[model samples]
Target: MRFSNYFIPTIKEVPNDAIVKSHILMIRAGMIRQLTAGVYSYLPLGFRVFNKIINIVREEMNSIGGVEFQLPGLSPNELWMESGRYEIYGDDIFKLKNREMVLAPTHEEIFTTIAKANLNSYKSLPQIWYQIHTKFRNEARPRAGVLRTREFTMKDAYSFDKDWEGLDVSYEKHAHAYRNIFFRCGLKFFSVKAHSGAMGGKDSEEFMVEAEAGEDSVLLTEDRTYASNIEVAVSYREPVGRKNSNLSFEKFSTPNIKSIDELADFLKITDKSRLAKSRVFVNVKTNEDGTKTNEYILALVCGDDEVNESKLTVLFGLGLRPAHNEELPEITGADAGSIGPIGIKNPNVKIIADQTLKEADELVSGANENDFHIRNIDLTRDVNNIEYYDIRTAKDGETIPGTDKKLREAKAIEIGHIFKLGLHFSQKLGAYFLDKDGKENPIVMGSYGIGVQRLAASYIEQNNDENGIIWEGEISPFHIHLICVNPKIESTKIFSDKLYDELGKKGYEILYDDREDIRPGFKFKDADLIGLPVQVIVGEKNLNEGKIEFKLRRTGERFLIPENELIVLLNNYKYLFGFK
Candidate 1:
């Protein structure tokens, strides 16, 4: 590709709205242009890198016995309704006006529809189907360039199996393929156990790339043994030594105790663990008649811990929002900062307490009245309708549930996720396979996905410096960037063309900068900005000396070498030099 003919509009200055390193570099490199919020247009330079990543994902999927298909992104509402996800997805899904259809954010529903029509026997027990397609979602807040786009390319794969054991094998196969795919794409990443949100399943894992600009929180141990997304991560807290006072709940006047620290100071308790917080949440559902009804829940947790709504959603349902301030007064008979599960006015409200409060006693809680609190409250005697579960977010210093070590926190981007969606879609979609005994059973399913554009962006997040992106082999737009220093010089132009042809004959993809209008320094800046793996420069001085300049983008290591020696180096380390 000749730079004069190619549209590599490199920007020297960074955009103001861009916050992350990847976002800033992508625009500066002229790889992508924002068409609108949550949407982007990949330029020629960017499209090559995007396609390279896609090819790696495809190869890895094919290695794991995956059969590719082109599934339609525009899916009927009946398909999502049959799988019971139409209402669950809510406003995040892109729905057509009065068309009873949606632009698919994932292909599970339509893929299940395909499976139900074919592959109906145990003989087709384990099959893997996949597609590299565009997906759409109405992201409420789209930022970080390609990181959180509403429309992006996704490599989504689904596995079908006859039994739970077969599903395990299929899940492991995908795990292996994902590791290879990420490694080949020149990303440094790790896998963590994750919560199955929206895509409900028994076991879920996410491939994470640690970045300061990442949105997801990962709770892990120092040794990396217990790694998980914080949403479903479990923690251990040392038991607070206190016996039940066995006293009846006594109401006390505590003025302006809005926070747990204030409550602790008023009660003369050193630790805030003895204080409990009462929070009310409501999940609204669309009834059969098209009316919405609220399901009220009282969530109880230690003052030190916050609620992990992702975990809470498993026990309850989705679409949980904070109850309105007026509604809270009617349900709990108290305003905000003064409510508890004991003696609640609403009988239909469900109460869920964190497991840390299971053996709690002599605790201080709200009195369910204005400016009043209750003392000497025992969990067993004070709250009869409470169910204890781990609905609290994992604290940083808290020990692992089964170990004595504390948990460590990391901010990371989710690059890929694989879920063991056993019978979740198949049973709902009526995709049953006949066994040898002639009995029908739902096919166990697993869903795996990786965002192609996000992967390209994440690569820059981890592999870039102040200069620009330090693109690596197997995913850089081109294998070599050939720059002609003062291409207006006949000798420089002749030498640059000779080297470009030489590399091309060697099967290397080269981006040759043969423009006489651009200065040598400007061409070099664009070369570094684009971050092709290797760069070759043919200048008049180097041509006079019978040597050309070679530079490695990753290390910024430059060397002067003759044409014969450069060819020798290319042949000796072709793959290491990012040759195709």
Candidate 2:
């Protein structure tokens, strides 16, 4: 590829809107151009990298017996409705043409529909079907370049099996493939247990790479044996310890002290273990008849802890959103931040408490009245219509369950996810297969996905410097960045052109900077900005020395190799550029 002809169009100044390092570097390197928020056009250089990553993923998937399929990006609403995800996805789904179709955010339903039609026997079990295609989601906030985009490419695979054991084996194969795919892409990532979210699966694991601009929070233990996404992370919180002090059913005249901190300060009480924080939410469920019903929920957690809404949604197996402030007054007869479950006026409301507050006694909470609070309330005694579950968000420094070491938290980008889907989609979509015993059973399934574009951006996140991207050798768009430092000089141009041709003949992918219109300084900056694994600088001074300046993009290591020895050194050095 000749730089003069290629459409890189590298920029000297960064875009003002570029926030993350990857975004800035990608723009400056002329790899991607933003068309609209969360949508981008991959230039020639960027698309080359994208294709390389896609090929790597395809090879790994193929190695694991994956059969590639190109599923449609737009799917009918009936497919989602049959799988019972039309409403669960809610506003995140991009509905098209009077809600008759949807841009697919995932292919589980579509794949399952295919399986139902063709895979009708136990002998067809253990089938791995995959596709590398576009996916769409109506993201509320799309940021961090391609890290969180509304439209992007994804490598999604679904496995069909006859039983749970078969599903486990299939899941392991995908896990193994994912490890290799990311490893080859030059990404440093760790896999952790994760919540399946809208995917509706179990035994889910996410491949995460730590980055400051990451959207997901991951919890890890000291020994690294336990790791999880914050939505489903668990920690050993200390049991609430409190003393009743002989105060029973006492109503205090707290004026305008609604929040736990405000109430604690007004009462001159520092310990928040005795304070109960109340939150109201509404769970919307759509019935088979297409009618929707809203269920009011009263959730209580220790004042020191905040409710994790994801965990609540998973536990209750429904779609939930926080109740509006105005809706609270009508349900609990109280204003915002002061609604409690004890002696609640709404009899139809379902009340649930965090497990941390189960044995807790003499807790202070809202009195369901204006400017009032109740004391000496026991959850086991006073709360009604209540259930107990772990709904509090896990925090840093919390002890790990069954271990003394505390949990540490970090932000990370989720590159890939594998799920033991079991029979969620199969059962809903009637994707069944006949077993050896002649019994019809829902096909056990597993889902695996890697965001190909996000993986490329994650590599940038993990392997970049101030200059530009440092691509891993195996995934670089071009292996060598051959720069003619003095293109105007005939000798330099002739030597650089000869070397580029020789390198190409020797099975190397080279990007030759043969543009006579650009100066040496601009060429050097562009080379650094593009971040090829290795750079070969052919300058007049080096030509006189019978040597070429070789620089490594990653370590900034430079060496002067004799022109005749270039091939041998480059052949040996490419192995050292990317993942070991």
Candidate 3:
């Protein structure tokens, strides 16, 4: 790829809207151009890198018997309806109208729909299908360049099996494949326990790159062993060390005490051990015809803690929202401000508590009436129908759950996710196969994904320095950058042309900077900004001495080598940099 004919538009100045290092460097290096908010067009330089990443993913996926196919970007709305996700996915999924056609944010429904039509017996028990295709999502606030694009490329793979054991095998195969893909791409990533989110799965894991510019929050243990997405990570704390004070429970009139903050201030208690907070929610249950079936929920947490909705949903197996005024009295038998677990016996409604509240003996709580409060309440004695678990949001400096390590925080970008979907998709989509006993059983499924473009951006985000991107050698846009410091000089031109021809014959994908009018500083600056792994500098002084300058992009190490030894030196450095 000769610079004179290539679209390598390197810029010296960073764009104003580019906030992160990758975003700035990408624009300056002419890798990509934003077409709209959360949408981008990859230019020649960018496409080269993008193709390399996709190829790596394809090779890894293929090695594990993943059959590739192209699913349609536009899908029938009826397919989603059959899976019951048409209504649940909401606006995050891009809906279109070729009268009734919809754009797919993911291909789970269509993939299952195809599998059900083709796979009918237990003999074809396990299959892994994948595609490297474009996915569309109507992101409301897409920012950070390609990191959060509305239209992006994804490598999504789906696994199908007739039984639980086969599904486990398929899941493990993909999990191992995903780790290899990221490792080969030279990404520093960790696989953390993740929420299934709207995908509706029993278990999930995300491959995340640790960076300050990342949007996701991951909790890290003191020993760097246990890590998880905040939604799923458990927190461990010593139970409150207080004996049952034997203080009698009493109710007192407390006007205008609606909030926990206000109640605690009015009670004149500095310690949160004595306070309990009640939160009410209305769980909307959808009927078969997509109608509403509203159920009420009353959640309790320690006064000092906040409810983690992700944890709450996992505990109850239902989505949640704040309670409505009309249903509050019917459910909790009290108004919003004065609802508690004490003496309220509603078997229809479920109650849950933070585990920390169990050990605290004498506590204050709502009195089940407006403008009234109860004090010296023993939860075990006063509340009959209650369940206990760790459902509270972890605060800073708190000990992480299931480990002796204290929690440390770092921002991270989610590059890939592997989910053990179980029967969520199979059951909903009715993708079943006939077993040996002639009974129909829903297929157990798993999903694995890699954000094709986001990984490129994340790589730049973590690896770039002051000059520009230091792309990992295995995935860099070009393996060798052949720069001509004085293309107009006969000696420099001869040396560069000979090397370019020789390297091309040797199968090196070289980016030859052959522009005659460009200055040495401009070429050097552009080389740094473009960030190829190996730079072969052909200059007048070096050529006059029958030598050339070789530099490594990542280390900024340069050395003079004889022209005769350039090929051997380049090959040795390529091997050292983990490139063939």
Candidate 4:
């Protein structure tokens, strides 16, 4: 690709709205342009890199017998309804104007429906179908460039099997394929146990890349053998010895003390372990017949800890949202700041407590009045009809379960996710097949996805400097950045043109800077911003000396090689600098 003919609109200044480095650099590099909030149009330069990532993904998926299909981006709303995900996805899913169509955020329901129409026997039991297509989501607040986009390309694959054992084998193939895809893309990533989220499944794992701008929080052991998303992470906590405080439950007048921090300060209490924090949630439960009922749940946890909503969801088997401040007065007859287990007069409301408070006694709690708190409240005796579970969010210093090593928290971007979906979609969509025993069963399925553009942004997040993005070897837009300094000069132009032609004939993708108008300094800056793995520069001075400058973008190592040794050195470096 010649720079003079290419459409790389490199900007001299970064966009003001761009907060993260990847977002700033991507726009400045002329790779992507935001059309609207959370939406972007990829320029030629960016699309090339994006295409390379897609190709890498395709190669890996194909290796695992994944048959690619070009599914429609716009899917019928009825398909989503059949899988019972239409309402579950809620505001995140993009719907068409007719209300009968939806942009595909995922293809599980569609693929399952396809399988139901086609496969009828166990002979076709194990089938892996995949597609590289655009997915749409109406992100409430999309930021971080392509990392969280409203519309982006996704490589989604689905596996169909006759039984759980077959599903396990299919899942392993995809898991191995995902590892290869990320590895070949030159990303530093780790897989961790993860919740399926809205994508209902029995088990799932996320491929995460550590980055400062990441949104997901991952907990890992020191050696990294055990890791999980914070929503379902488990940690060891030293048992708190039950203090022998024989104080009875008593409510007292405490003016303007609602929060635990305020109560602790007002009562001059130093130990926070003796305090219980109450939280209210509005849970939506779906019955077996597809009816949803709204209920109020009062959750209690240690004052120092916050509730892990995902754990609560798993416990109640329902979708939950934080109760609105306006709804609190009607549900619990108290404001959010002062609601407590003892103050709740409603006996029908479900109350769930954290396991940390099982034997806890003499704890401070809300008095249910406008401005009062109850001290010396025994959790076991006073809090009635309370179910205890492990719903506390994991923290940094907590020890790993059954291990002395402490858990470490990291901010990471989720690049890929693989889920053992079980019968979540297959059963709902009636995708069943007969086994060898001639018994009809729901085809066990698994869903695997890789965010193609997110992977590119994550690559930039992990490998970049002040200059711009440092494109990885395996998935770089181009392998070599060929620069011709003072291209107006016949000697410089001749040397660069000859080398670029020869390199291309040698099967190297080169971004040749043959533009005569741009200054050498400007070209060098563009080279650094684009960040090809290797740069070969031809200047008039070097040409006269029978030498050309070769620079490695990653190491900033410059080498002056004899003109005759150009092809030999480049051929050797190409192999030596290949991605692991």
Candidate 5:
């Protein structure tokens, strides 16, 4: 591809709105143009890199027995309703104006629907269906270019299996494929145990690359052995409560002490272990008759610990959320600031406490009255209908469970996720298969996804310098960037033209910069900015010496290769640079 013929409108200055390295460099390299706030148009150069990554993903998935499909991106609302994710996704999903259709952010529902239509029995026990397609999400704050876009490309796959064991095997296959894809795409990433979120899966793992602009927080041990997404991460269990078999409590007036910090300060308590923070939640269940039943719950955690809503939601249900301010008065008899289970006005509200508080004694809690609190409390004696679970967010510096190593945290971009979906989608959508015994059972499932654009941006996040992006491995826009330093010079142009043709004949994907009237200095800067891993410079001075300059964009290493020997060196490129 000649630069003069191709349409890469390279910019000298970075856009003011771009913040992350990928966003800044992509624009200057003329890789993408912003069509809207969160939408973009990939130029010819960008599309080449994009398609290369897709091809790599395609090859890996195909190796894992994945069957490719081109499903419609717009799905009917009935599919979402049947899966019970229509309300859970809320405003994050893109829906049509009439609310009858949706632009799928993920393909689990549609794939399950398709599985229900085709697969018959255990004969189709395990099948991986995949597609490389665009997805839509209504991101409230889309930033860092394609890293967080409303419209982007994704490689989504779903596996149908007969049972849990089959699902596990299918899940591992996707995991293996994901590892290969990331490695070939030049992305440095680690997998973390993650919550399935709205996907409603049993266990999920996220492949993430560390970056400053990342929206997800991941915790890792010193050896990087144990990793988890902060939402469901449990580094270690905190010891908080004293063993109190039976204890008593007394109500006390504590005016304007709403928050745990404020209450700790009011009581002059520095440790905060003796103080308990309470939160009220309501899960509204929609019945078959179109009526709703509201179930209220009271959650308790140690004063210093923070509540992880994801953990809570996973424990309860998707409808579980912090109760509204107005509804709190009706459910708990008091507002959020002073609501607890002890002597609570509501009898039906279930009390769920953090595991650390099960044996806790002499703990302080709310009085269930305005401007008042209860002290010297024991949960075993004072609270009824109580259960213990891990509902608190993991804090940094906490020791990993069963290991002395403390957890370290970093922000990372999530590139891929694979889920052990079990029977969540199949059961809900009535996708069942019959076994040899002739018993119809819900098909176990596994869902895997790789965000194509996110992978591109994440590669840039890890492999870039002040000059520009380092297009390495299979994701490079071009294998070689051949520059004609003096296009106006007759001898230089002739030599460069000949070399360009030779490079093409040698099976090198070369981008020839043969634009006349462009200064040598500008061409050099543009070459650096474009950042194709290998650069071949043909100049008048080098032509006279029977030599040409070869530069590596990544290492900035330059070599003076004899003009005739250059093609011989190019033949050894695959072993040296690992380019396609």
Candidate 6:
């Protein structure tokens, strides 16, 4: 590729609206242009990188017996309705054609539909089907460039098996394949347990890359052995010690004692052990008759902690949100700030508390009346109908479960996910196969995904410096950037042309700078912006010396090699960048 003729636009300043590093660098380097919010057009350079990533994914998937097909992005609404996801998915799905058709956010339903029509009997026990196609979702707020696009490309794979054991094997196969794909792409990622969320599965895992600008929060142990998306990660601590049993339960007249901080200050207690904070929630469920019921959930956490809704949902097997104003009176039987679990008579209400709170013998709580509070309250004596569990985020110095390491936290982006669906889709969609005993059984299913474009953005997020993107070698747009410091000089031109041809023959893709008017500094800046793995500088001075300067994009290491030895130098570094 000749740089002069290519549409490689490089900008000096970052865009004002770009908050993430990848978003800014992508726009500044001219790799992509925004067509609208959450929609973009990948220019020539960006497309090249995207294609390379896709090919890598293809090779890895094919190695594991994956059969590729092209599935339609536009799916009929009847198929979704048959799968029972149309109502559950709500507005996130893009419905079209006067609410008759829909754009698929994923292909599980479509794939299952096709499988049911064609596949029957035990002979088709295990099958891996996949597609690299466009998916659409009506994201309420799509930001950060391609990271959270409303319409983007996805590599979604579905596995069909006859039973649970077969499903496990198929899920493991994809997990192994995904690891190989990300490893070859040179991404520093971790596989964390994930919530199925709207996907609806019994088990799921997400591959994440740590980044400050990432939307997801990941909790990690100090030793990095146990890590999970904050939604599902569990933290450990010694059970809160029980106080003396003789402490009396008494009511205290405390005014405007609504928050934990306020209660702590009013009590003049340095330790949070003396306080219990209660949070009100509403459990929303849709019955078969299409009626909605709001069940009030009062969750109690330690004064120093916050509720993790993901853990709550997983424990209860239902979706929950903070209580709304209209539902509070009927559910909690009091105002929001003055509600308590003590002496509550509502049958439609449930109370749950963290294990740490149950161990407290005496503490402070809401009085279930306005402008009043309870002090020296004993859980065993004052609170009734309570369930105990770990339902809050771990503090900084808290211990990690099953390990001695202290807990730590960071923000991260999820690039890939693997899940053991276990008949969630097959049962709903009636995708079944006959067993060896001639019995009809639902096909066990597993789904795995890798966000190809998001990986590109994550690369920039973790590896960029002050200059621009520092692409990892395996996934960089090009293998080598050939720069002609003075393209007008006959010797410089001849050296660059020969080098480019030599590298090309040696199986290295080269981006040759053939423009005559651009200055050396401009060429260097553009080279850094595009972030090719290796740079071969052919200037008039170097050509006269019978040598070329080889600079590595990642390490900033530069060395001089004789012009005749360029091919050998590039060949040696090829494997280092995952080219084998």
Q: Give residue 378's error in model 4 in angstroms.
A: 2.0
Clashing pairs in 4: none
Model 1: lDDT equals 0.87
Which segments of candidate 6 are over 4 A away from where they belong?
97-99, 286-292, 345-347
Angstrom error at residue 528, model 2:
0.7
Q: Locate the minimum summed-lDDT window of 10 residues in model 6.
A: 336-345
What is the Å distance of residue 428 in model 3 from its true position?
3.5
Per-residue CA lDDT of candidate 3, range 146-196, in tens? 899899999999999887788788888988899988888889888888888
TM-scores, one per candidate: 0.94, 0.95, 0.92, 0.96, 0.94, 0.96
Stretches of model 2 off by over 4 angstroms after superposition: 242-244, 285-295, 384-386, 577-580
Q: How much lDDT does each candidate structure score? A: 0.87, 0.87, 0.83, 0.86, 0.87, 0.82
lDDT of 4 by residue, 1-580 (tens): 9999999999989898899989989999999999998999999988998898899899999999999999888888888888878888889999999668999898988888789999899998799999998999999999888899999999999999988888889889999999988988888889999977765677798999989999999998878888889989988665443677788888888787778888788878777766788888888878899898888799888888889999988776657888888887777766766777886756677888788788677887776666767788777777777888898898988988777987899999999999998887877889888888999989899999999989999999888898887875778899899999988999889878888898889888999999978899999999999998888999998789999999988888999989889778877676434533
lDDT of 2: 0.87
Tens digit per residue, CA lDDT, model 1, 406-448: 7888999999999999888998989999999999999899999
Itemize residue pairs with steric clashes in candidate 5.
none
The Cα error of candidate 2 at residue 359, in Å, is 2.2
Candidate 3 clashing pairs? none
lDDT of 5 by residue, 380-443 (tens): 6777668999998898899887879999889999999998878888889999988999999999
- In candidate 4 the C-alpha lDDT for residue 271 amounts to 72
lDDT of 5: 0.87
Error of 5 at 479 (Å): 1.4
